[model samples]
Target: MLEFVVCFTVVAILGGLLLQRLWHYRAEAERAAVQMVIANIRSALEIKVAQANLPDGSLDFTFLTEENPLNLLKVKPVNYAGEWYRPSGADIGAGNWCFDRADKTLLYLLNNVNSFEDSQTKLLKFKVKLTRLPHSPAKPSGAPETLGVAFEQVKD
Candidate 1:
């Protein structure tokens, strides 16, 4: 009886530990996937900006900020749920990507909330906007300031 009890307790402890580790790994994987999507969107934005600049040099960026960032991508991510004006959690559900046109923000609903750090919100919000790079001292004083688009995280 004593040996059986000890074995049972050991198994329970091991199982709990394994479950905890799995959750940790799952959270890390989720974060990595979100990062990869953000990187791809940023790359697409850079390409769009470059293409616009090729024409003349003066390119209007106001339109880009209002446009859906995913539209710039050749192929949208499979998990993207599409655009919504003002979506609730129930509207989009968990483990999906949604763009809120009203707020001009891209949101990622997290599937695993256990290991995620944000206690206030289960979703991650990001935005694409025009950003100006600092003028390089190496360049001449008369040189034009460099402008680019940035994919930035927004707290909501």
Candidate 2:
């Protein structure tokens, strides 16, 4: 009986360790997905700015009208940080989505859009806000902290 008890304890320890490893891997994968989203959005935003007939954060046009310039590109997630082999709701939408070009200084930075409509499908809506760097329209800061997991496996 003593020997069996010892063996069970060992197995429990091993299971715990394995669970920890899996969690670490999952967290890393999540981080990568966030980064990919940031990169893609940044690139699209740059293009919009270049073709923008108004200003950098000008929302006064058709595709990016000053009133509703939130429908820029059909934000879609083709990848999920080289992880999650399945289609993660952590992706973008299937239609054009605009960027909030309205003084992304304090509010924008604080409330950036990390992902698109897809993130909301899995109830992970508003993962993070992707904001443009201040005084540096040519540059952007893709902070990792901003891109965090919003949902977790809920317990019954």
Candidate 3:
């Protein structure tokens, strides 16, 4: 009887540890998804700047999902938290983006960042920034001479 009890206790402890690890993995996966979205957006912008020769590349929030020169639209269009990145028309909901033509900067703002995580105390906000530089004729074309993008998480 004592042997059976010890085995049950060990099983319970292992199960609890597994569950905790599972949650951690889920949170990490969520973070990675968000990072992927930012990377794709940055890549598209870089291509557009080089190929299209866009001086400023100022675009609206809807441009991220629009089909054309950049073609960044996804069929599902869902973020990590299973949320829709709607167009910035009358609503301008989650996953909104803006590009400044004058400053050559692109900014993405996502709402309800904490919803992606299990802990209530882990409040976060995601901001993606892209900057474009002036490319000269003397520069090479192997890399992006005109643009760069960065992503950051903010505590809110």
Off by over 4 Å in 1: 56-58, 114-119, 136-145
Tens-digit lDDT string for candidate 3 (58-150):
543334323221134343235322223332322333454443333233333444444364434322334445556577888888855455444
lDDT comparison, 1 vs 3, better candidate: 1
Total clashes in model 1, counting residue pairs 3 or more apart in sequence or in different chains: 0
- Give the per-residue lDDT digits (tens) of candidate 1, residues 26-120: 88988788878899998988888888789675577778889888898888888899999999987777888999999899988889875357646
User: Evaluated with TM-score, which candidate comes out highest?
Assistant: 1
Q: Which 10 residues in a row give candidate 2 its minimum summed lDDT? A: 103-112
Please provide TM-scores, in order, for all candidate models, with all chains considered together: 0.85, 0.40, 0.47
Better of 2 and 3 by TM-score: 3
Pairs with backbone N, CA or C atoms under 3 Å apart (clashes), candidate 3: none
What's model 2's overall lDDT? 0.37
The best candidate by lDDT is 1
Using lDDT as the measure, name the better of candidate 1 and candidate 2: 1
